[model samples]
Target: MTESADDAVLALPDRTLLILDDDRPFLTRLARAMERRGFEVTEADTVAAGLVAVDKTPPAFAVVDMRLEDGNGIEVIRRLKEKRPEARAIILTGYGNIATAVTAVKLGAVDYLAKPADADEVFAALMAESDDKAVPPENPMSADRVRWEHIQRVYELCDRNVSETARRLNMHRRTLQRILAKRAPR
Candidate 1:
């Protein structure tokens, strides 16, 4: 008799999970949910704090927000990999982009998920034995939505500087401001 894949995931004993996010409420909720799922959850609000926590006790798994108050979540994932090479990591972000997603994967993250991911999705990503089982997006973002998100991510990368963002994007400052002023397209 052999244990099924689901059984193997459920049988993972009280593994430690480090969750890094600036959103306090979401972090707390996710920590609790993962805890209930048999993980010892550690929470951090910034990349610095998360790095400190990782140094103190490297978790077997990590779920990191792509954006943090102090820095990008990629730093956390990189540090965790340094401390524990086999540690599984996932990147979660509200601002998803192809560049950042590729960077996350390059930095040793097993998966990248957009924001509003529930515990089930996070768990599945962490417990996955192979990338072959990765699910394709059910409803991929529209081109307009992708462009909007990319502009927003670039703006953030430029520290919310309208002029710099415009320069980097090769657009007029006023035009960038107008785009930023409007609500993001769905």
Candidate 2:
């Protein structure tokens, strides 16, 4: 039994899929959904477990969290690609950044997606058939909004220290304070 949202089946010779994430609930839900969608799902919560799975049986597809509690998912991607050169992998992360995305792709990840992405989006990323770039997001974030989001993320990573965050972002402390005090842009 499965939800209709995941009823659409994926036809492929090797439907084996490896999904690694520390979020237990998300991992369980995604594992179930992928199973219903015709994948032989193997779920792991840590990088070590992911590596074991990759070594024992390289999956045809993988969805790895960019930053696991134990280690970065790039190591898993690297091992999976070494074990199975044609494996398709995607990095899922809450802290999405250009540097890590580029690293993931360079290590043979098929795509990089932000956290909270739905099953359909993950499926689409894994199964893309061509070299075409991603289509524009239907509701692209405004540039102001993107800047705000980046600033907020950096701020949090800086432990909410305004001076450190401002210094790292190369913005005046007063300007950052003003932005932080306002509501996020739509």
Candidate 3:
């Protein structure tokens, strides 16, 4: 089902939202956050469960983590869109990459955001594009399409040490410090 920009703008009533993620802690945190916003939320730890949940009871919106233990989030998004074409979707990914981002958008995701994303950021991404509009070009990282694939590798190699991570990336410790400060809330 194809939806246009105008179709996205249709006001989303207060309704149940679905979130798909394999990490139990993250899923719990996300559900609580969305609940705080007056949205009833349901969570699934696997793509198959998420699909089944939507089939049983369609949600108003969905936030799907790109990587799942059993399957990828893009598959969940596809099934959700198929089951409930009107449900708005936002892709959440820790394994951010250009291919995944493009695939999510092509599969009908409203926006793609990196993991550790704050609840506000997640909600904004889904709502902001209710008009199905493309993200603004001026937005950094929004259009860059280059996922921080190197950052994780460096972080792992550095044993999650900010100083070492900075050194390996050939960037100032303070710069890496600033980026670390903005990691999504767990």
Candidate 4:
């Protein structure tokens, strides 16, 4: 009977979930909890590395920490969508900004969860996953909007290099030069 039950559990559909968070303890606990629920989890401590993980294996769901030592989580959500448009995204964040939360929702995340999100909350967001598409429709200022969504993406990709930022964006070095030139020094 035990053998039969084990086989039955093994027969269940496999769900791939990617977790991106800088907190090692939280990430490990989160991964283990989901694993107990039958999900295969992949983890990354940095946004740049997380993007590579998604590129290597597209996940059905992603739980992102809003803040990272290397960068913010929203950009990770946006990049995941770019890679696998259908992957459901849940933002697990300690820093809750109404504007950022609303902006995250606009980018295609299924839900924005505050940090300390429990297994139940994670499961609930996963259950609430939808293919309804990003809100407000796609637009020309998408680059700008996504840029505005979070500056971390650019920072992560550029390795904080402004010269390389232009290269990655495929714009003239001088063009990126002009754009940043307009911004007040941080």
Tens-digit per-residue lDDT, 1-186, candidate 3 = 986433443434646789999889988998998877667799898989998988898887899998888878888888888888877899987777666778898988888887768787876676674565654533345322342555655675578898888887889999877766665322
What ordering of candidates by lDDT runs from best to worst?
1, 2, 3, 4
Q: Residues 66-141, candidate 1, lDDT per residue (tens digit)? A: 9887889999999999999999999999888888999999989999998878998898899887546788876778
Candidate 4 yields a Cα-based lDDT of 0.73
lDDT of 4 by residue, 1-186 (tens): 254432433464647889999989989999998888777899899988887888898787899887888887888888888988888888887654456678788887888776667786776677652654433322223455445334435644478687687677776777766666564222
Clashes of each: 0, 0, 2, 1
Task: Encode model 2's per-residue lDDT on 55-103: one tens digit a residue.
Answer: 9999999999988889999999999999999999999987676668889
lDDT measured at residue 151 in model 1 versus the true structure, 0 to 100: 94
For model 1 the TM-score comes to 0.86
Cα RMSDs, all models? 2.5, 4.9, 8.2, 11.1
**Candidate achieving the largest TM-score:** 1
Candidate 3 lDDT (Cα, 0 to 1): 0.77
Give the lowest summed-lDDT range of ten residues in model 4: 132-141
Model 4 root-mean-square deviation: 11.1
As a TM-score, model 4 comes out at 0.62
User: Which portions of model 2 show Cα errors greater than 4 Å?
Assistant: 1-11, 142-145, 148-165, 172-186
